[model samples]
Target: MDWIAEMTDEDTALWRSDLGLIADAARQAGDVALGYFNQSPEVWWKNEGRSPVSAADFAANQKLESILRAARPDYGWLSEETDDDGDRLSRETLFIIDPIDGTRAFLAGQDLWCVSVAVVRHGRPVAGVLYAPALEEFYEAVEGGVALKNGRPITVSTTPLDAPGRFAIAEDVLKAFPEALKHRIERVRHVPSLAYRIAMVADGQIDGTFVKHNSHDWDLAAADLILERAGGRLVDLQGEAPLYNRIQVSHGELCAATAPRLADLLRGIGERRGS
Candidate 1:
């Protein structure tokens, strides 16, 4: 299937309005996060130590939920900090949200955290915004317009697969790649927020990155649209883009990169998967 489709003029205007609404709400959510950034907030763990949540997260989540739901009460809601309702799967459109995508980084006083929100219709993201107040960066996209970072357009890198490049990858995933591909990988680090990592790829701050198994829809939704609009693509290892707000919001191995490099990474890994 095509990554994005041609939108009619009417649809374009509608998506643009959605983008504007989400951006304002996201910025407000970011402000709520700022109130708790770098200060100790009640911290807790989730998924048996696989993840974290803090008071800042809930504050931001409540702010976003109140704003967005007031504006679009009919839209479904799926958020990292909220309990999911089976009702979201039935809506034609919904908001997928993560009030604080990089809680660990935020807790560590790093500037990598962000507020991510997206509008998905028919399983595809039509509008999205990623606002990182700590980093002073805001990335946004609508179906018919170019992606932007703080009012400036953004795009992915063209760094070749054979060229040295920085990547965000799990140690185990990197080790699984063949040595030839491994040699091309450079400046690797673990990023706490999957959304921020994808945003970095869209803005060309890094070459590319990989997602491990079981990343949720809230983690990937907004940034996925930004990367795609910025001339990059985030997709499953099988070369298909993600569909958000499914009956199950979980996803398997995913990758994000400029189009050509994405194909290159997949081919390298697919061949090895068979060996």
Candidate 2:
């Protein structure tokens, strides 16, 4: 439960190595996605059209799962491309992956898509990596450790959340709120990928994100851990820590910020949303 004592120097080194290997696997997965990008092999929906998943996602998942399992067979696997395999619960460490985080963007030939990877232990993320192959940017973090982009250390900007800082949010964020707050914050940018949006916050490209419900553990786990390591935080609008790998994988509305200003944003958002 404690991060300071758990993340020793030795632990950091080992996580760093694992992150590099996972990044390589992610890059390979991105290469698989590239083959079908814009070519549109097939597009379909599961359940209620929550989101679109393509053949490329499965292909990239296969490539990534193959590489990771080959290297570390004992680690459990959890991925968006495959059906939920309950067997992962028996292992102490699990690999949570999103092969193509921004499938919509990728299918549209946008370069904002990415491959996200994370190692979780006892319901907490210990290491995380995100690779945007088209953009050639790699981001990673070890728990209680540094966040890096392309092997260079990165930190979130200490910008005030109430100020005119950039905000990245899902398309439905405003729709879920009352007219008062919905019309109050007009500078919101909608991004297709959760991990990419979190990365933007870690690198100070964006100030914050207001995420409505319905994101899964695999979608935000890696990015959440990375943002914390980069001097930022992702918490529920009610000011509680975000949990992972629960029976209900769906997450609640969240507010992410580089500084403690998340409290201010979340308070206002909560009132508007009647949460």
Q: Which regions of candidate 1 deviate over 4 angstroms?
A: 1-6
Candidate 1 per-residue lDDT, tens place, 1-275, comes to 25346557887888899999999999999999999997899999998998889999999999999999999999999999999889998898999999999898999999889999999998989999999998899999988689999999998987766687788888888888888788877756777888999999999989899888898999999999999899999988888998888888899999998887787789878867973
Assess the local accuracy of residue 171 in candidate 1 as a C-alpha lDDT between 0 and 100: 85
Give the clashing pairs for model 2: none
List pairs with backbone clashes in candidate 1.
Answer: none
TM-score of 2: 0.89
Instruction: Name the regions of candidate 2 deviating beyond 4 angstroms.
Output: 7-10, 170-186, 273-275
The lDDT values for all models are 0.90, 0.81
TM-score of each: 0.95, 0.89
User: By TM-score, how accurate is candidate 1?
Assistant: 0.95
Best by TM-score: 1
